[model samples]
Target: MIRQRVIVHGRVQAVGFRFSARVEAQRLGVSGWIRNRNDGAVEAEIEGEAASVDAMLAWLDEGPPGAEVTSLSTADLAPTGERGFRVLS
Candidate 1:
């Protein structure tokens, strides 16, 4: 398993991005946390199997219905061994 930190840009906040991420991550059996950044973006840390991690990254591209995901930037990170996905306030 591996971890990735993704920063979603453009029309992400207040548009259900974090909520959708929570659901998607759980469904994919991923463990991580998602929250809004002060710079008007949504940041997330996801860890799981390789295939599942790829799936999550792809989902972040489109995001939720109301979200206008302009783009997403990701970086590799050491696995945190997180247990569940959460929407951090």
Candidate 2:
């Protein structure tokens, strides 16, 4: 399995980005959590098969139509061994 931490920037807050991320991650069979950052970005960690993870990253680009993702920075990481995807408080 591949694990990754992603920081998505640009028009991410107050636009259902986290909610959409959870739905998309579940749909893609990814496991992790997504949350809003103080810096006005969306942060998430996704773990799954490489293909699924890659697919999820691609979805992060457009992000629920309302999100205008200007950039996404991804880094390889060890899996947190999380159970499922969720929207973090």
Candidate 3:
């Protein structure tokens, strides 16, 4: 399994980014949580098989149609054996 913490920057807030991420994560059979940051960025931690995690990251790169993702940063993290995805407020 693999885990990653991602911070996405851009016009990411109030554009359904968190909900879209949850749907994508569930579809990919990955687990994690995504939330909006006060700094107008989106933050998330995803864990699952390497391929699934990679897929989730790719989806996050584009986000929903309204999002204009300018940049994103990621860091490796230990897997937590999580089972479902959530959108945190």
Worst 10 residues of 1 by lDDT: 13-22
Model 3 residue pairs with clashes: none
lDDT of 3 at 72: 84
Candidate 3 weakest ten by summed lDDT: 80-89
For every candidate in turn, the CA RMSD to the true structure comes to 0.6, 0.8, 0.6
The RMSD (Cα, Å) of candidate 2 is: 0.8
User: What does the lDDT read for residue 11 in candidate 3?
Assistant: 97
Candidate 2 lDDT over 1-86, as tens digits, reads: 98999999999999999998899999999999999999999999999999999999999988997889999999999977788998
Top candidate, metric TM-score: 3
* Per-model TM values vs. the true structure: 0.97, 0.96, 0.97
CA lDDT of 66 in candidate 3? 96
Residue 10 in model 2: shift from native, Å? 0.1
Off by over 4 Å in 1: none
lDDT per residue for candidate 1 within 7-75, as digits (tens), equals: 999999988889988999989999999999999999999999999999999999999999999989999
Clash numbers, per candidate: 0, 0, 0
